[model samples]
Target: MTAPHHDLRQLQRQAGELDVRLAAARHTATSADQLVTAVVTGQGKLVDLRIDDRALYGANAQKLGLGIVEAVRNARNAARASSLPELNALFGLQPPPPVAGTAPPLPPAPLSPPPQARESVQRQAEPDDESFEEFDFLTDEEPESGGGRW
Candidate 1:
């Protein structure tokens, strides 16, 4: 009767339907060469693997292994890609409501410093003699440079 109770019941029904769909979800893929085939569930469990007899006939073992992996990956990717659109539709989701009106008033214009404060900041930024000193490492008092070697 109330809005919250109705929403909860609708959500529970949708969840039950989604659970049923997920339990039924499956994807199958075969390698490009049709040598390997794989079937996976929405939960990404490998339900079946099939290898053609011709695939095993003098096929490189490593290549066959790679083909099987590729098939499984393709199946999982297909399952994910197909399920996403269905779930989105079931939930009635859309692209974020297009930013209502005048772009949220532009964050209150960033509070600039007054001219006097800016001048003070500029004066402080200028280097003073007390902040730095030049040092000469080659001043004529070093023993090795004065031609005295131990």
Candidate 2:
């Protein structure tokens, strides 16, 4: 019983130390084209952002937005990588191998479906000639007398 209590106390102490370390941690990353940079905390909260004047010279909103997102994502990954060892130790897991870079390359964006597939979807969505009939708006019938006109 005492042994278990001692172990619990030790774990609590280690967790406290980890919390302090995380609070003091900062990680930085830059966009591939050197256009943007971001700094984040160990908890992956953005602390700073920097953009090169060149990036804004002729850039559209979408291009600048993507650069900012990339930098922040990389910075967060770096912070997570840096904290992995301490986190593993706290949980009694084996130390992870050294990280070579901020993080693995992000997976490629999904590609749009082929033109043939798109055409097929459009064909399916079209109304069949038998399914809908045209309505004539030129009918000569008079309006019903129930409601008065404005």
Report the number of the highest-lDDT candidate.
2
Which tens-of-lDDT digit does each residue in 20-138 have in candidate 1? 77657777887767799999886568999999887765533336766787788777777666555555555777432232211221122223468898778767875642321122233
Model 1 residue 58 CA deviation (Å) reads 3.1
Pull out the clashing pairs in model 2.
none
lDDT of 2 by residue, 13-128 (tens): 98898778777788888877778899988778899999988876543333677788878888887777777767886788975446523345343232346889877876787563
The lDDT per prediction is 0.63, 0.69
Q: What TM-score would candidate 1 get against the native?
A: 0.52
